[model samples]
Target: MRRPDPVSRALTQVGELFALALDTLRAIPKRPFPAKDLLEQFWFVTSVSWIPAMLVAIPFGAVIALQLGTLTVQVGAQSFTGAASVLAVVQQAAPIVTTLVIAGAGGAAICADLGARTIRDEIDAMKVIGISPVQALVVPRVLACVFSAVLLNGLVSVVGVLGGYFFNVIVQGGTPGAYLASFTALAQFSDLVVGEVKALIFGFLAGVVAAYRGLGTKPGPKGVGDSVNQSVVVTFLLLFFVNFVATTLYLQLVPGKAA
Candidate 1:
């Protein structure tokens, strides 16, 4: 075989990584859904994460509405502002933005937890006892994130719409009913389903990527922090990359209509 160029080698490595991830997914145990674990995950996403994500989304919505209003005033078709705002925020802003908040807030917490576990030799101990670390550690966290993301995205979508409307109707006194009508008319079930699907993928990815990095930490104090930081950076990068590819595939190649 001839020597490969740097670009080709990098691509090959990425391919291997994807293949390994697929293997891991297939290896996941086919067990009953853990209700208690899911409940806890819901709590984390709802009570813990929902408010913060909403807080971030609300301000984001306000800013978008303000900008949209300013832009549309000259065109005299400001009635479309609400539809525009909702479409923009829901696609990538609400769910994707909530993922951002989660990475900084909840994601860091998860990273630190795993890092500490690794540092204290708990992971080693689990392996020593013939336990699957993926099941004990990775699965629960992943489940929690996936569940939490659904709730957080739902909250963000609702709050984002309301927040955008508040800015449009209350702040700018734009036509609230007209905006709502436009949104309802144009908003398809496909958009909502796509947003939810994105949230699920994003949430699962956030947990797995963060846990993987965090669990790989050396058994030390500094290692814990370093892993957490790295987890955040890596997960952030993956989130964007996945978004681009997933959305492209979703819009262009995927079939069966929107919903």
Candidate 2:
């Protein structure tokens, strides 16, 4: 059966979020960004996932070195493993992984919490009381996502690099410093720039998508479940597709190509 258009109401909430983000930005007449909230959000995201990330990252880093070793040796390019691993982890994996982690854990949690409030008419009650749910509910989260993504990406970069180093040098007896040094020699200023820029954007995306899904929640358990599932799937896909677009645009405008 076709579902009713419960989503129509959500458009308003989504618009409000964009406005909040924009208004916050515009209020800063001198600066181009909102650093404090962004930083706070980033720290929250990073701190919240520290334990899980540490647990997973160590094994992931170890396995990557072990797996790449066989392939690198075949081409007699064992030395390039560090550089290749670093680039792959930093440029490719980190942002996407952070998004997934947030979506699966933080995003889902937000959606459910908000959706529960929505089902119980708490959101409607807010509207009745002249409360700006956008400010009260959405702003913190949107800001959190933006900052969290940045923070997590930074954390990811550090862990990824160090993990690759330990695995290569200690575990596999490979030249570990190659990966750390690769950023200096192989990567451009633009590469790091775009990666971080994309991280901020991705964070907003995760928040916006999550909030949209959450606010549209209907008065039922099924609706909440659907919202959470959809939020994660949509968000993860959006991150990758958006990442691709950003990379393409960067190469077209910037001095160097990503390839």
Candidate 3:
């Protein structure tokens, strides 16, 4: 039989991952949920990724303040600088930062761990013992990714806002009261919700892609390396595409009018 084309093979792999994700989701309602596994993975994900996420966020926030603060100051609308900073960071930067950490750090870690297990026959050993690898391994990691993304998004928001405030007020010599006062003037609760939602979905997709690639890895060091590379690349592509679609729908549906 003729070998399938690369596009055909790629489509098939995507469909397989989707089916696996659906199966994992279906298993969620079945008791007893793996609380212990979830917590352990959560701690692992957060401990590994938090610092990097914060580091990226602070610089981004500062840059935004530096650019926007300068522009707004020239127009005599310095107070609105804080609001713009809040809107931009919370609505876009924070979520993207969280996703970068998830796709780069967290997803790579997951892929490496599972790829090691795959090449070592641990997965097959679990299957021999009648344990489902999806339940025993993938589910907990997925939960951890989602949980960690939300947690990191919150940290990013705080760091980004504080970084913007510090840069705008301290470095740029803006009035403290004006910076703090107008911070929430144009932001809405919907922005926070949407940001969190973006983080959640990005994390879930990252975890799923990593797990799928890791599980399908062949028995070699090169295979594991390829899986890790593919995991990061695919997760990033999915993230950007999803971000566009999600942001568009969110803006259309909520519009997030300030109170």
Candidate 4:
């Protein structure tokens, strides 16, 4: 038999992922919500991701502040540095950093756990007993990721803004009052709303992708590892693409605050 072409294989995988995502969504509103599983997973995700997210957010914010500070000075718009940096952090960097941590830490763990179950035939056993893996396992994990991402987005945003503020004021000799004032000058509340929205969607995508790859694992120890890696890589790609699209739509639809 002839093997499927690359495009066909890609399309097939996309179809399967889409179907899995649909199943997860449908399973979400069903009876007997897995609150315990969700709480456990939420705690797990938070425990693994929060410190790393904060560590990364600090440098991310500092770099944005440094770069934008330099650029704004060169352009003779140094007073807008805080607004630019805060907007960058809150509107883009925070959600991306939060989700990256979620995908790398929480998503990888979820993938590995589910993949292990798949290799051990536990998923099949559940199916045989009329238990939906999607409902019993996937939904809670996905919701956990969503909840974690939303909360972490807020945390990262605050940390990032603080980091940026410090770098702008102390390192760049920007006035603290100017820095604080500039934030309200250019950033609208919608900027924040978009960031949270990105976090929510990105979380859902990360969880679904991880679960799909995990459930599709081949029967070997190596297969579980490979699925975990693939899930992270796939989640990262999807997050960036979705972020770009979401940002573009937000820019088009929501008018920026008057400077």
Candidate with the greatest TM-score versus the true structure: 4
Q: What C-alpha lDDT values do all the predictions have?
A: 0.77, 0.71, 0.89, 0.95
User: In candidate 2, what are the lDDT values of residues 1-259, reduced to their tens digit?
Assistant: 7644768645765576566557544443433344564466556656666566555565666666667766897899776676667666667666777667777777777778778888999888999997756666666667777767777777766776677778778777776456456445566655666667888888788887787788888779999999899888878888889989987787688774332
Candidate 3 lDDT, tens digit per residue, 54-134?
A: 999999999999999999978988878888888889989998889788778878989999999999999999999988888
Model 3 CA deviation exceeding 4 Å by range: 74-76
- Best-to-worst order by lDDT is 4, 3, 1, 2
lDDT per residue for candidate 4 within 1-259, as digits (tens), equals 9999999999999999999999999999999999999999999999999999999999999999999999999999888999999999999999999999999999999999999999999999999999999999999999999999999999999999999999988999998988888898888888899999999999999999999999999999999999999999999999999999999998898988887
In Å, residue 181's CA in model 4 sits off its true spot by 1.2
What is the model-wide C-alpha lDDT for candidate 2?
0.71
Total residue pair clashes for candidate 2: 2
Which scores greater on TM-score, model 1 or model 3? 3
Models sorted by TM-score, best on top? 4, 3, 1, 2
Error of 2 at 241 (Å): 1.4
Query: Which residue pairs of candidate 4 clash?
Result: none
Ten-residue stretch with the least lDDT total in model 2: 24-33
Worst 10 residues of 4 by lDDT: 178-187
Pairs with steric clashes in candidate 3: none
Candidate 1 colliding pairs: none
The Cα error of candidate 1 at residue 99, in Å, is 1.2
Candidate 1 on 1-259: residue-level lDDT in tens? 7899999976875575455346446545646435676567556645667678878998888898889988888798787798889877887788788787777777777778888998888989999998766665667777778778876888898898889889999999898788888788777778888888888888877877677767778778889888888878877888999999978887686453221
